[model samples]
Target chain A: MSSIIISENDFLKFKEYFYRKTGMLFEDSKRYFVDKRLIERIEATESDNFRSYFNTLRFEASGDELQQLVNAMTVNETYFFREEYQFKCLVNSMLDEITHKKKDNSPIRIWSVPSASGEEPYSIAIYLLEHWSGIDKWDVEIMSSDIDTKIVAQAKRGHYSPRSVMNLSKPILDKYFIPQGGGYQICEDLRQAVEFSRVNIMEPADVRTFRNIDVIFCRNLLIYFDDTSRRQAAEMFFDSMKAGGFICLGHSESMSRISSLFRVRKFPEAIVYQKPLEAL
Target chain B: MAFIKKQTSQVINEDERKTPRDFNGLCVELNHEDSKVRRWAVRDLAEQLNASSVLVTRLEHEDDASVRTAILNALAKLGDTIAMNGLVACLRSEEAALRNEAIEILKELPYEVEPIIDGLLTDADSDVRIFAVNILESLRHQHVEQWLIGVIEKDPHVNVCSTALDLLSEVGSELAIPAIEKLKARFPDEPYVCFSADLALKRIEEGSR
Candidate 1:
């Protein structure tokens, strides 16, 4: 079988189908990425061009092929402490706000949407354990999710490469991780703190399940979205957060044009948004 | 000779002495007939003498856009006036990617490159204009604050307008107060315009306080 050459028409068809099915719009620039990912499917199925490969995906024997397609399409680059200042704010100021707003010893729920390989949610878990006292008394839950099943499986393993562990401070590393052969495995305590699941942010079921989250760390994921999709995602984020809860974004991402629901907060090195208590 | 030190190796030879000059000679091998050799030389030169006037002068005229981009980036990293004309010439390139990269480099320079950047504000490419606005915002070049305010007042792109508004709020220039107030008066229904204007007013008020 020869390698399939992806044409513009095939790219458009895939883009339109994906958008219609999942509400995740892919722009014209992602043509290269789509071509690269789908060629593997074409090679595996011994089909030429994206049209036959896409047909195989639609009518495959097992559902796993479609899952692989979604997995290939989803972008999942993340690291622990990806945005340092936002985490600092969470540790320093946002914790106080969360504590003040919650009833004494009530469970504080946090979600890391598109959690990738689980570095982000685990980072939050470590933060909570280190800073917040009476952790056992407070029913703390960290819900970590990603659209890719493979990454979700990896996330559940709670293992990481040395490079991924770079952002983790020495103290945190020593406290929360155990030395595995080459990479470190998250200690049982941190691993148990989060519930890992495969969840596409564009799926209605996934969004509905992530309700009443006290804080959301959905950073860096919005840049891929078009304007309408971004607005829809913003609305979903707004719905997900509890009253007075915070939403941390990537350093470059801003809610300025997309949503008025979030009130932007300025810290020295970071910007975040808060869903107003009054609005809630 | 002043920069070089005498080695105490017992096996001193003429070829070894000539090796330094050979490496220097390979600098011209950068222009060798082989594309691979020329490419490697260009990359090596870019890494070694990023801002050296001689390297910058030579590489700025390279046929390859990738090579020219590397040169522009190296020049920006050096932040010297010697590379300014080359950077300025790049801003007018037909390629949006090249022009955008040049604008990004100019924005990083400490000196006021606002006049050049401000000219790009009206470029047909929205990304170029947006990046130019971002650079001005980062620099807090108050001279261009009015230009930004004009963007907020009149630019068709909401993202550009919002970016300008956000920057103006951050800079908290008193001159922008009227523009913000005017935007508020005209676009009362648009939540972003109102929100940005209010934030700017709040910032100005807080500054006075």
Candidate 2:
């Protein structure tokens, strides 16, 4: 009849277990945040205490509860200029370096996967147009994909609610979008700039065509996958990239934890991972 | 030429076949000179339920790391008995990279690897037995604690027992307490084994209360 209390011991136990499983560590300051979610999960699962719920989380054959806990713990949102520093790095540091090594007039390729509601791909288009000087000198192709055809369709539509574009400046918005129905419809240039496709990165057939990509923003997607899936995804991305091409993950996600393929490159704007220039 | 609008997505349409994609053809591509061709062959072969036996043969000689990784992923995706056996063979590989990669892949395969884990734990090589305990660290099965207990209780090698004992301190409960005590007694002279077993016991006691 009573709710369970998460003791200090339980907190320590769960913290270590969660960190090992998900590679996300909770500091003492995050105790309230972690415990609130743990108790919520315990209650939701109808388990009397943290022990039973944790046992279910740890040993559940289907691993569904662990995924549920992951969903509860992580924030999933999409917006223009979300983690804007990475985009700044893309324009200031990454693209310049990519172009410096260029020997031909081939177009630069950028991929934003899980094109969630179109914020990320369109944001990349805006960044290159407004921030990068090389946009006029070099041709760029921005291609985005998501596993869900519905989301891919929504992305191609190039429409966004106000919250999705809250981070954009007035000039950037004016230059790129038209105010429509209290929201914004991205201009035809930015919409047509990105090629949207339905792609499951996990499937070999789906990803085989994604060859010679120059930059990839695979932010926050690998966290949901199991270790094998994560490694497989990394392998697929490695094959997809041009030698020395860069990848940007969510700030909290580390490529080192997922795979040994990529070399970590520390730029002033952000840290990104790079495929080796002479990789075989 | 900035943002050149393509009339159609060429990538989606044009995947030129370097080799025929039939079952037998994919198998032959495994021996292809170009590693990328071989890698694609491995990826496509993952769809074939019977590709494991063909893949296992290539795992031994695949020299390119990327291509080898693709083979490992395909093998693990199949995860049938033959595939699992091929992975177990990798534990004995001369290359540490391949062996460690095999361990990581095996950790992903709780169901297929479960029946063979006991044999791995009792493998003739002490190093292989130690690797088996390492697999238990992330098996995500209820039997992991029991497997660790079995290692500490029956494994003759001190290092193997020590590896499992270190894990038990984290995952074991009161069920493992008695074995923890006996393990400390079993290796009275080995400092790490004694310390780890005691730590496991203390943690178990605190946890149970």
Candidate 3:
């Protein structure tokens, strides 16, 4: 056990610095959680106290420690096929329509923004391969990105705990993953299918790197951002996609609240946003 | 398939089976003379478990524009790459609407359309090269600077080089200053290339500063 304590002023300093860096707002309700996570790092590094740790975070030349802190503080709760219906809609209708109009050999592109671990995008690959027989005939590019460099690195490792894959069917599990130690490691083929990178959606330059996306899966990420940052992210996605491209938010998130640029589309399985065909 | 866990002595059950879809009737409706029926059939096939093959085969011969669009959309939803060939061909379409539609799809497929766009960049038709440059302008990629610099240095078409310089003005860094200088040296006679190169050079210098 360690005896690291965080003062109120030091906590506020961390809050402000974190918000400035990642646009993730920490409210009063999350004080205990944030304080504890920060203290863990202070003790691990043998720092004097929270104030000194704050100084290191703010003035540090390298962003590596700050990223580790982000990995510690943020909640990366996700699983394969967490929202099966959204993927169902993706395979059932969206790809069909996009491929129908495509007469050339251009591939269809999908983005899983803040893809957390590799589960979501790997799930996407597995689902598409299983449900869509025409998958191999079309060039399909899947990009999975997250702001937390640690998590992105973990995603690239393609390892998952048992809980992260509970929602996956046994056949999918057996076919795509091999049990490793107590955890499961994704197969090489499925792992290679998704390209993983780090991106902060709040930053315009970062988001600008992703383009011409047909479908975007930004589930459960916006809820962590403030209203202003949320609006910026929505605008970024709107600008990043093609006219008539689809966006799937978390079950609790609504495009109506984020931005009015996207039209709400109701499918039999899920409700998503679409950049209208007329949109430039 | 059933797997028995030796340690736990438990048999993991396979997934619950789904009801089979009527792909045959949907296939028949796809060939209906009425474009409306064909369109509806295309949408219906998208709902089936394994109608992608039926949709891909029908898409090749479908004549009605509306039905063809429906089939394309359906095939896209099915995640078939067969529609890509047709969509790429549309980039060369003389019809403005068809060409615009194709560009829309191609623009959304940055990674997949790179090769096709590369082919167009050096096409004999300067208009095609301009179109390729315009598409590259909107896309975001790590190698965009490299591609733009290549065009500015080597492409003989002033319009294409100007387009590349315009994009460089937005995304370029100090690394692009030399490329802009080279463009200026390459086409001293072209006023627009020189002007755009000046603007790009200024932007890159200001950014680096």
Top TM-score model: 2
For lDDT, the strongest prediction is 2
Residue A151, model 3: lDDT of 88
Rank by lDDT, highest first: 2, 3, 1
What are the TM-scores, per candidate, against the unseen true structure? 0.43, 0.93, 0.44
What share of the reference contacts is kept in model 3? Answer: 0.00
Runs in model 1 with CA error above 4 Å? A1-77, A134-137, B1-209
lDDT for B44 in candidate 2 is 85
Rank all candidate structures by their DockQ, best first, as comma-separated numbers.
2, 3, 1
Provide the lDDT at A140 for model 2: 92
TM-score of chain B as predicted in candidate 2 = 0.94
Query: Candidate 1 clashing pairs?
Result: none
Model 1 docking category: incorrect
Candidate 2 or 1, higher DockQ: 2
* lDDT, candidate 3, A91-120, per-residue tens: 998888778867677557789988787888
Q: RMSD per prediction, one decimal?
A: 26.8, 2.3, 18.4
List the candidates ranked by TM-score, beginning with the highest.
2, 3, 1
